[model samples]
Target: MAATSSLFSLSFAPSRRRSIPLSRSANPSSAPSDLSSKPQLIELEFLGPKAGGDGSSPVDRVTAISGEKLLRNIMLENKIELYAAYGKVMNCGGRGSCGTCIVEIIDGKELLNERTNTELRYLKKKPESWRLACQTIVGNKENSGKVVVQRMPQWKK
Candidate 1:
């Protein structure tokens, strides 16, 4: 039984190694073509309030695949600061209920999905530019463009 098991293992080992090289060779050739045909990347620029509280802040640029994620998720993934000190402690964790994840859309509004019902109720009196990041979807996955977002509005800070 031992001898038979060892023979079986040895026979399969060489075949497994041979298959690995064939799969690796095939994948590299196909990967580039697939990437080229995929949709263009969406660029996001997050602007934090100026330290002086008087002018534009420096831009933190990030990119994502269109329509793949929410604004809050993208900001968190990139380590961009999206909440005020109070909001950090009280945010609803992307459920669109707490309204702590609000941001201003400075540009590329068309790339995002329309305001959700939660946003409409929460921001009824707020500017049209103000959006709840947790409710904002970045793109339609088909459109690609630059979106500028102002993180943590000054009033909140």
Candidate 2:
């Protein structure tokens, strides 16, 4: 009972917001910093389970510009295969209608755009980490300049 009362009192305590000016926040050093540097590039890693069930993983690397191309395009250009049936058929053709190109976001959840109506419909029962590669666009400053993803580990029939 005493612990609960103290918890309640703490919850009611006033909040202190420490706001720092944007310029100071960006430059922590006493000396002025260079402002003309280019934006940092992101390293995108794509991996998959190797065939023959050997438990080996093959990884592909690609540089990314946040908020640019869709994930499928990047994977295609970089030769990363998130779907087994890729290049075999239309496979929704980046339409986000089919969930065949699902990939698991190992990191950088906030970098991708919001889910589309098609993704919302198809991915209802899937885990939050799962997203349609065709529907996801990688690259965002909020992701610490990197994004990592893997092919979905399992398929649902």
- Per-candidate clash tally: 0, 2
Per-residue lDDT of model 1, residues 65-110, tens digit only: 9998999999999999988889999999999889999899999999
lDDT of 2 by residue, 8-46 (tens): 877766432234345543655733554444455567877
Best by TM-score: 1
The TM-score measured for candidate 2 stands at: 0.65
Cα displacement (angstroms), candidate 2, residue 14, comes to 63
Q: Residue 21 error for model 2, in Å? A: 33
> lDDT (CA) for every model shown?
0.89, 0.72
Q: What is the lDDT of candidate 2?
A: 0.72
The CA lDDT at 139 in model 2 is: 61
